[model samples]
Target: MSLDSVAENILNHLWMISWQICILAIVVWGLCKVFSRSSASFRYWLWCIILLRLCLPGDFFQADREGYYIPNSLPTVWETPVTIEDALPENYTGSSSPIVNEPYISLHLSFPGVIVLLWGLCALFLGSIVILRAVYAYAQIKIYPRIEDPAILNLLEECQKSLGIKKHIEVLLSPKESDGPFLTGILFPKIILPQHVIHSWKEEELAPIVLHELAHLKRRDLVVNWLQILLQIVYFFHPVVWYINRKIYTERELICDDLAVFYLGGKRKRYTKTMLRVLQESNDVFSAFGAVGLAEKHHFLKTRIIRILDSKYLGYKKMKKLTLFILTLFAVCSIGVFGQQQTTATKAEGEVVVTYSIFTVQDGKEKSLNPEIFFLSGVDVKKQQKFAPGEYTLLISQAGYHHILKKISIPDGVKKFHIQEQIQPLRREIKKTSKDGVDIDVVIDGDFPAGERIDPEIVALNGKDVRDNVFQPGTYRLKISQPGYATIEEAVTIPKDAKTFVISRTLSTNVRKVITQISYDVQDNKRPQITMEKIGTKEKILINSDTKIKPDSYLLHIYQQHYFPIVSKVHVWPDDRPYVMQFQLVSKPVRIRLDVRYDDKKNLPQQLVTLSDLEGKAVQVVHDNHRIKPGKYMLNIQHPDYTFGREKYIQIHPGDQFLILEKMAKKASSPSGKEYTKLFFK
Candidate 1:
């Protein structure tokens, strides 16, 4: 094939594969939305799958097979060679035919050829721009000087140690003060920091900055950045690809932020403030060099800051192995479905001409086929058509007729074949009957007392008892009633078409007088406030004595000063007598004092004490008294000078309790010279 033909073929293949790539991209995008709350690294990795799929061929896992030829509305014409004697008529006296002596050639480019040329030129143009930008950024990097400050070097070393990174990384100071910190280079990874930041920022403030850049190295984001650039160069025309690229970059920064927060002992406020300051004072200039930065885009600053403060990001939970496996499996399956090549049909010389006809079987007789009938394959087989000798599925369908599908095979030696199928007409039976009474069943919807039997006579139709459970086909008033429930009154119509009718209703509770009494033990003789609330609703009514309220299942609540609130379920039945409920409220315990002391018996002041549930959720400390609900809790103590191990699991119960925690002696350094503190509580 000529070069143009070859290029056209490749372009056609790419165009086909581009749609498949788009499908995979959409699938990955949807999965990312589904797992939006998952780890940012997981989402980033999910986007990487699309990039990998884009590099695959269209028929990567497709199997070679024979194509099946099916006829369409267009008829195939065959031409035969004719001799000179056969071409001339018997009455013709023509001697010769006219001919031209001059010769000319016509050069024409096909539509596909033009498209291929355009695509090539556009790709070349964009690819050149990308290369030039990368070159310029790299050249700019060569002019920047590497930092040699001892304090900054020590801080970098400490950050590296904290992140457990063993790779040799270089630190460069940007020539301009507006440039932010970013990690560049794949082989020799270098971290570029703004000159002003290095001179003005404190070591404590710079720790998170260095840690964020080092995280990119630890996660090998630079390599992924190169892949992203390559995808952009290839699929530059695809808008979805650009959107996905933006999402990948956003998630990448979020992942780095998570890593930075984790290594900083989960101090998000300080790190977030530093990140905001850095982004505010810096500009995005290193991304063109294919580098990953802390804040690459100003618009993403809000998202980054919000995500930094989010508890989910702060927790930094890794994606589960099962979830990862499922996602990978789904992507692979999608590739298999979308990447498979479509079979091409080719006509053979030794094919058979087939004619098809349909007839309907009505009233036990064959009749002419309906004009509305057609084949499911969308082939109008009114004329004869050539087909390869193979098995084919014939789908004949029409309105008001049962669809028929028949399989037929044409023998190789056959020159012609006829396929005739009979379809059965659909018949529906309709019955006409005299109008009659319908059975009316009344159903009561409510929480009834267990083992309580309800009589059907409670329901009355048209102000009369419906003892027979049948009503004539006419409109009538329905009155449904039950004890402790408001009576329901409505007009209902019984239709002659339906054989039975059901009336279901939920009756509201009836209003009644309620009296509640509560007693509690306290230092002062004070009456607690009493309130009554209906179950499954937000309506609350204060009750003391002879308070008119709905009669149903309600919650009785009593609250007093220095006492635990009491809640009890009370059921009031319908009666003329006053409903009375009594309850005894328990008094709350005194405040629990937490005493933390060193081995020398000195109180540990300025220490942060927190009580959390077993699930790590902070428990509310009421009135600075540490009065919490009785349950098992984990106690955590934080101090700048002291090191606390894992949280202590403590069980709290009702009543007065005292906790005394004493610090043990510092253990000898295990060669690393790291001191450890152990606390025991009783």
Candidate 2:
């Protein structure tokens, strides 16, 4: 692709966020279907066409062309090179700056993005299928049983008028009816009044039943119902959002019912009675495909009926302009919570502010040497409350090395800068040695000199000239080659304490055949051994072990790589068999001595407490509840609400008891208590 095309493609990809698009698609399909007529199916089709058009490969397709709809909204990611000193808080007492200059790239396309795409596609597909099925079913019903009752038809007309909603309501009678009344027009708005139901209902009973269903229809509750289905399709991955949506749907139904009751006035009592009778008799008419007979719909109807029957009715009062303004302000403030921005300081030099940091390179690994790595602009660069010229200093250094000081002069107009200091080589002379019968002296060189660059081919030992050293008993290799000079090859061996000389034989152009041999003393190998001791009863046990390992520090695994790590400190002894000594752990201990110390000079209380089990139930004291004896004893501790604490454990005798402190952060709180309860006890 051309660079421009590639750039455009990248920009477009960056602009697209599947989750936001899915939300837009849902909003469009829902609001349009709710407001428009089924006869205007083309309009619904048009909405889909517009969405597909945006996703298609095209030119000059601005993201904002559709206004708020389909505009991929995203959070911002900060990207700036900053010095280490900039990252530190103003009151930081540490010698190094805390500023981190590394740019932060927010990954917009996360798991939710993929999930949202799947959700939107599923919603669109299912919604289309449902719409087609409902419309086709409505068409077939229109040919079967048309609205015949003039009074019922007039009531429907009056209901629509009274509700101030203008829409065509297809009233149909089905021979396939088993029992009861139902309202079925969610996608293809229709009232499927069963022939059996109409025959059984009296004139007075019919009006309320029809009105209850009409109330749903007039409010476009069908559209909302369909939208709910669409949202479920997208957010099926999150069960919580589904639960929230379900509650919202139930609340929505209740609100509609309240409106219907208010409009009917005194007729609400009769309406409610008719609702209960219909619910009881027409239980078989509950169609899963319809809008009015959902599981929560019936439950909501009962609640509404009970609420209206038991309570003194109060009409909803319309808010005045002043009240509306105040309410709007509160709403805006609520939404503002989601619009919060993270403020970071930056160095401003003239119109352009610059913030930068320094990085160090060693053995091909780049490490940021600057301690303070963050810089902010216009805020508190120095926390002086007054704007200062954005200028910063950074120093980079490593152990056993000289420091590289950088004067970060922010150019008058530069906004950001990145400073890098190439590390200079700290060459050490490898002296010749002769011991146990070998002798050799070799000089190894090649650390990138100041202002000098080393070719990666030589560094990687790929091709080109390489520095050579005589074969030695050490853990290093070398190559020797100089520009415009014949290559020389020599072998040298160094002994423990004896001095030896390595005489380099310069290579003539025609010379070949050089022998190289490396010799070094090998120490005896020893395998690391582990021993675990069980200190408590069968149910409770304390485990401890020791090992004399060749490596000073190694990974100590309990179970395997799966669980968290417990780093063990290895202690070596002069008379011992180079083995680990001991560690302490409490299995299921009745009482554990908490070894608490204040400091190097002060001693603190060492309290003894009984252990709890995984279920937060105190371990049963079979023998003694007061004190556990010195021998190995099994104790069970169960704490249901405090699982993460050291409530449950096993005890080991003849060894120091160490209670495992469970982190409270890992505990889950019950929903019945405070909205969010503490996961951990003291």
Candidate 3:
């Protein structure tokens, strides 16, 4: 596949996964709210489920099935194998012929392509932001000095042991006093402390801070933080993702706080006091750098303080049963959301009830499949029967209709099978005879009016002479001939029940007469030579006043020296009346007459008038008349005696005669000068 197609597939998958995540997030949110009294650790795990679902690939739970079986064995009833060609009508010509020229292919972008392009660009932009932010965060943390104080190292080791964390973690001290203690890093985790907190705070007051930061390490929240960041970058356009990310962050902090309070010997007041002190002294710049900091926004801080101070909130035990139930529920729901069965045709072993209906193609009349004539593998079949799972060939033959032979397969699991077939009628030679003479009507180009009759010469039927337009009732190749019309030959069937068989045939004319009339916009004695060319042929025929040509559409090319050539399409039908083609040609040169109606005629000679074409090329004017090519031009008239020069835009068409009249003041006046411009045809 092309890159565009792959990207489009990814975009479609992302859209599907996005909505699925939205539903999962809503469900998890509702569960967390309903279990409000539960431990934050439980709610945190629920959000982790959302994160895990985001990482799942599309089609993770789809089923796979085998291919369907198609019956290929022929029936033994018909010893001679029948093919589709034998079932087709004798007059069937198949489909129409392909076009001579290749079709034009369009390069226009489709709507889905545009959408995919936009999605790719946005994803690339968000990805760039994420990478840059990560890089900047790494650089910011690298500058912090590593803490070497034995007292702080001992305190950290004590906290890690208390939290049952076995991994080795680094410690750093921030130089700025406003920076709070935050937990950063994944593989080599680090906890950065504010400079003032290390120097001013005592061991008792600082224990809660160290414990809170270590609690993040125990919960493996740094890894979850990375997942949240990845999802935020991928689903940047999705509002639900951002909402869920916020909830995860809030729940994550609360869970860590719970761990810190528990490790601090259940002294909620002491832990709460240290959290408030850290929040007061530090800003939230570390969180933007992907660090789990003690500082939070005012609203989130308020909720945290309220939850920590509430005596009953911390007393609630972890509901392990409820957590398990919710986990199982979400697991089932996830399976329902993402699980899809792979479609395949499978074969099975079972008896299939088969029913069939046959009909004539010409008329929608249903036909019966006789048991004696119609058979499946030489076994006589009924209207409906139970068949073992296997391939079988059915042969259906009617008197007038063509025989139908089909191969069908009965799969293992199919309970019922329906077969509907439309049979084409065969072209059988008519053997019936009629008594009275057969009446024949011949129409020349649909020209025969009502009650109007013209006798056309009857040629021959089946190579036998047609006597007085009468014939024995049988199928014959009827041939018709007329003086001005083309010959017509077709098969005709005569019925025995009818006293008189009527035949009607319409014939097209072979040749037509065309009359050409040429008129010019400008009166001239020059006559343009008109040539005619058929639509798809290269031969050009010269057309005179009266021309006789085949009945087809033609392109007429009329051209003369110093005149624009005219090309037009003319359709000549096969009719009695001559086709008349009228064309009007235009001359190449345009005429312009400039009449200067000035108060003083002597100033006209001093008027420097020039006409410039649209390209600013000047056209020479002689005797106040200019003959130039048809186009738009600028007419500028500048006189030393007038107050202002007159400039106007004019358009000249082929064979156009324009007269421009301009009245100018005799003397150069101030603001009250009068000027009149009038344009008309000569």
Candidate 4:
């Protein structure tokens, strides 16, 4: 195979290995979360189970090549003889057949993208849960009272003191009136109590319940619960983790139950019965101290019941041994799987060593950037030397900026080099400003000669620079009193792009604030103008010159300032001077006149409207008690519509013309009516 193909194959292999490591890491994390609180003995058993799966009796840890002595593209100095054990494949094999062991990832399809996509989905799942928790808290606060009942408040205060927790606690009663208790709190912890149980329980019975919940608070079970929730997010795709999560939550409740029973000491039996009763009366929102008898949580309670009643307690000596053994096993496995990769780099000095270094500079000053940002350049940061003598090319690029390229050759003995490059700041200039009383118009251009790509400042004509960001187009006051100018004030309209030109005149004296009208006539030029006037209603509209227009078209769209626009289509061409465009406005219909322009070099229509003699007929809409008065009025709609396969026109107003096409349809359609209708619509 070619070198490119070989390199590609190697990269694919590495990618698969990396993906497997990531999956294994995720499984490890889930296992850690699950068994962290389990008995140390149980964790050792779990580790043994996992190790057995990884190193089944006949599995090969090293690749085998018995007789091959082929040279590799990657530098190799010596060829070592391979024995039968060393000649085994990396995968598991049976006595009669060979099978590839792919426990962490499937090998059927080489879909490297799936690894990143799955990881992204995992992150998104965790992120969504976090966001949902915040939203749920907000929604709860919006609906529930900030303060709890005085009776519950006093209980919490006493419990808080007993628990030695520094944070204040709030209690809320569930107004939903449901059975079963649910403890939910984190920052600014709150206990939601069901009204039913609190009313039913006597003062003496409440003490044990309060003690149980206070135990949860003392141990910071709420935070642990959040951690558990986060772990579930990481293992969202694993069904086993989900099952284990449900089990762990149940176990947490049981652990809390046991602690509560111990706190009661001599009255453990009575408290357990009361706990069961509390679970029964859990209709009230379960405060942290209370248990709601939710059917779903009953299975967990049953397990807790069994564990508390059972008399199987290990002595300290055995417990200590179990703990030490589990911890040691975990440390060894973690170091072996993950840490070994680091130590494997320390081989004899025949291998080529690659190093990478990033040089960052901001405003001519060196700045520290995160090493992760350098990963865009292909480099294994952990395995490769960070800074070493070598020939290397560096490229730096950020959003909305040109890329920088630099090449440097380091001598054999040199360890590191720091390079610097100055990046120019963007310059923004205010081209023009026009103000008409309350409203102001400012023009800005992003393009400047400076190396930067953003505008710095655009001062208003009369007003101070409102803000740095771009402003909406309109009219504005022009006032400028610089040191050299007497008084610079001009009305300016900011154009979209090109030159940053303003038309402000200087005044005699320099002053801070002065109101003056400024015209943004940066350059003098004559151009065709289109205007519309409503006949009797008296509404005048101006058409923008920079609009995208189609040629040989009769349709022109006119927009009113701060109002819905009007669409005009040409209905008829009368042999007259006005050359009016008639259109109907769907809402508050307004009549407008347009000066149609054709190519000056081409043959002009026999009777066409010109810019020199452009007169518009005014449109009028008489409104009487929400009903429009019917009247004979002149309207202008531009552009003809091509509806059928060929061009067609719809009437714009009451007195428009129509075309008769009797045989045209007959020629285009088949004998059947269905085909004729299909052709009509199509």
The list of candidate 4 runs beyond 4 A from truth reads 1-110, 118-126, 146-154, 282-296, 313-337, 341-404, 407-682
Off by over 4 Å in 2: 1-144, 176-189, 284-298, 315-327, 340-682
Which candidate would rank higher by TM-score, 2 or 3? Answer: 3
Residue-level lDDT tens digits of model 2 in 220-274:
6666566656555544454544544554455455455556666676567776877
Instruction: Tell me the number of clashing residue pairs for each predicted model.
Output: 0, 62, 3, 53
Q: For residues 21-114, could you state the per-residue lDDT of candidate 3 as single tens digits?
A: 7778888888888988778777877877777777767641121212122221322212233333333344644321100111112234456667
Compare the candidates by TM-score and give the number of the best one.
1
Regions more than 4 Å wrong, model 1: 2-4, 59-108, 283-288, 311-314, 341-682
**lDDT for each candidate structure:** 0.64, 0.41, 0.64, 0.39
> 1 or 3: which has the higher TM-score?
1
Q: What is the TM-score of each candidate against the true structure?
A: 0.44, 0.34, 0.43, 0.38
Q: In candidate 1, what residue range of length 10 has the lowest lDDT sum?
A: 97-106
lDDT-wise, the better of 2 and 4 is 2
Residues 412-495, candidate 4, lDDT per residue (tens digit)?
322232232222221233323334222222322111110111222345543566433334445556554333123445666655
Model 4 lowest lDDT segment of ten: 95-104
Overall local distance difference test of candidate 4: 0.39
